[model samples]
Target: MYSVARPCEVRWVNLSQVVGLSTLRSFLRMESHMSRCFAAILLVTTLVAVEVPAVPALPDAQVYAVGVIPDLRGMLQHTSQALGAAGKTLPPGMLEMGLGGMLGDPGLTKLGNGPILVAAGPGLLVPSWGAILPYADAEAVIAAVSGAGLLAEAAPGGVAIGSAPDGPGLAKRMLPALDAVRAGMPADSDLRVVVGLDRLSQAYLPMAIAAMQGAASAPGLPAEAAGQRKLMLGMVAMLRTFAAQAGALRCDLTVSASGWKIDAVQALRPGVLADAIRPQAPSTDRPAERLGAGDGPAVVQMHGCMPPRIYEAMATLLQETRRDPAAAALIDESMVAMVRDCAGALTGSFAMRQGFAGSPMRQLGVAMVRDQAKAKALLDGARNLFSMGVLADLMRGMGVEMVFEPAVRHAAGLPVDRISYRIDPAKLPPGQDAAMQAAMMPTQEMALAPTMWVWGSPSAEIDAALAGPRGAPRLAAEALGAGWDLYADLDMALQMKMQFALMAKQIPMFAGAFAEVPCGHPMRMAAALGEGRYRLVIEVPVEQVADFRNGFAGMQRGRHQPAEEPETPAAPVF
Candidate 1:
């Protein structure tokens, strides 16, 4: 989170009302019948006790099934055929969309008359529903999607788990939320509101890659052709499944006088959320034998199994993914000469420090001794037999996409988005305050601004330190390690969110309001984020106060209405 030097008092004055309401609502909801009426009286008294300011409701939203179709090309082709003669004249770029593709064909205006799914015009397709990561481009996407008012407006893009607290009893928080909007709803509202979630299998990625590999190695198929047909189909399946899950998925939304006020049950899409919860992967994949014999999930407790061989393999795999301008030239160099000059040094230079053992080294060595002979063998039986087709098939079974998009959205029984925080200022570890101070410190002299944001891509880097190595009972262990009876990162996000919620009180501006300007310079963005190991923080700019109010108001009411002003006839001026 970024820090700014704003008056703490200024922030507080803006937040009193929200805290008052939350506190009041908490105190008034009594379970026993005898105190029910008394609870109501307390509610009114509580409301009367503090400043009752109207704060805009933030967009606590999760639109379940916004499907993205795979292969925008397919979409384009379908769209093109629909557009008679103009299809032939279409520029290739017309088919490649960034945010939303701009099809030169006027007929393709509306995104298919069907459902919601995530797909790409090309290969950067996101799975059905998940989270969009990294803040720059991610922030832009979130701003646009939320701005379009899918379900709700956003309080800065912080990670949060919107689930009821777990224990031997009811989570005390939900009671207040239920009470806050329940009375304003109808009896049938229960049916309208439902909680729904979708999670992708962990194998989604590996299998996707396998499919692409299979296609690429197919007999008589061009590279693009193979990718276009086989891999594209797999992507479609992913989108279809994601959307299908979302379409059928039910989320508990409170039917409000405004619209659906969703109380999202926050969890994470499989790969991501589970990563923080489960044991972390060893930095280096060792031999299976290294892990030795142990119990629990498939992850190795034995330790020796995933020796440096896996890391060695991965380093070569990394090289395969790299495309240097000089690759073809280097490949054309006489194999023997190249090896003497290049082979020995390159392996030594790479990270991971592994010697030539993976495919690249093996291939390079083969090229050196008998270049044409090795080439003939690769082209003849050896390569064709366990062909690239074999690998593609493997990836298909694994659900891996050949083209990688760093971040995409998905739904996995958890929240694609979330918020958390710490309220009891004293509960913070001694050094934490210093960390928070550093995070909150402003990057520049725009110190006049009240908000500070560690405003770049917000993400969670889970280490085994949080979730003990493989099946260590993460949450409990983390709590113990942290010297607390209990603790969770999401819980921390929640606490911070609550603090913001509190600030949103007297400072109506704070309610679901946040602005994070990525460092004063984009180059410094990474440096800024790395400065504090911040969970989440968003500062509200006082100058743009009106826009914030209007945005929040729209969320609370489900739509924004232009403020009204008295009208005077223009006839007087005439």
Candidate 2:
């Protein structure tokens, strides 16, 4: 018999001394069974004790996005209800299958309602990305997705999946960053995306600069090519400087049954670019409010200040172009000076409006002036250059000649110059002269005052602009009241109808799809810019949402229709 060892004692025995051959075989089988049972128990206990691991930090990563779903089941139910309300529904059993089933893992339906992390890194070219997904049972998930050809590994409370060779490793490395992002996520945010702008600039700016420099300095290039290369190099250099002072850009999105909203901010380091973008005190007199409330099919209005850095960059680029003899011959020093002076005289704050009135489109542009005398001088210089036939000479090779006629008119007690242009029919293609003239703008008018400069197409539109705001304002006024820097509203249905009518012959599908679109509400957009951040909100009303769904369904059905050829192409009425 073999002696068993006590806690503090040791003992050894030969196999023959321990047991007989037949008895030993029976004992070996029993021992093997017991070992397997112990391993099974250990695995169960370990899995029970496993807690979700902290997301790994990826400091070198360039982009990171996380989508937090507090209750995936509830979100899915809400989405289904919303679709039903809009007269749409998903295929039967789609929700039960879950996203995993769509991805070739039907058994991976039991996912944890936690934040999903996706990240891409340091390398710009051939950048690698990884995703981490929380799971109710990591082992079960791994087994379910085993045949999906995805690189997946079990984490503490989730599964890490990656793009190519060793994707799981990348996913593991990204967990810490995900944890950090979660800590800072907004309470109501369903999604957050972070872009490491500075890191990107640091990694790729030098390479871009070097490449542009080489191109600019290359020998035997044409004069125009050399000038263009130099201009591009200058612009890239400016962008590098601007990016160096730029930090990460973060955007958070909040979704609800009503609509979705996104807030984005970019951190700006202390630099000239930051100063240029710094928001100024609110202005009492917004030019956009002066835009006429036209009874047109569509209208667009925008008001914003041009950054000083943009003007400086433009001047620098123009100077760079002048260094090349061929480019200088085309854009003389006087022309450059005139452009620079005109740009400098403007106070940066400007407003623009465009209205689509049935056939012809009308637009008005207004710019606040710092010095009216300087602006007038610049305008006079431009007219002199035009009279010298500089523009005509430039367009001569293109089978076109510009004929300019200037007439002075009065609007709101200011002198408005009514200018019209007629093409020289002799220079036009033989049979296309009348069609070309029909497409040209009939007239353009401009008015310069002490405080502002206004210009637009057609005399009537100009008069409306001169006559300040009418009775009540539309959605754009509400945006202004909320302190949005810029606002735009467009009648999507009207635009779609116009586009379809214009292209019905070439694209027969559009005509059929247009019939399905109900008269929908306008789409509205509002944007605000501050010292270092920008926020934009685009909203389509619930009514318009339904319209879009029906329109999309119609388009799908019309996609298989054959095209019809027309003898005469539809001409645009202006």
Task: For each candidate in the order shown, give its overall lDDT on alpha carbons.
Answer: 0.23, 0.53
**Candidate 1 Cα lDDT to native:** 0.23
The alpha-carbon RMSD values of the candidates against the true structure, listed in the order shown, are: 29.9, 24.1
Tens digit of per-residue lDDT, candidate 1, span 140-237 = 34444445432211122221111111110111112223233223333332322222233222324445556644543456542223323433343333
Per-residue lDDT of model 2, residues 274-333, tens digit only: 554444445544565556555564545555555434454445555666665535544556
**Best-fitting candidate, measured by TM-score?**
2
- TM-scores for the candidates: 0.17, 0.67
Top lDDT hit:
2
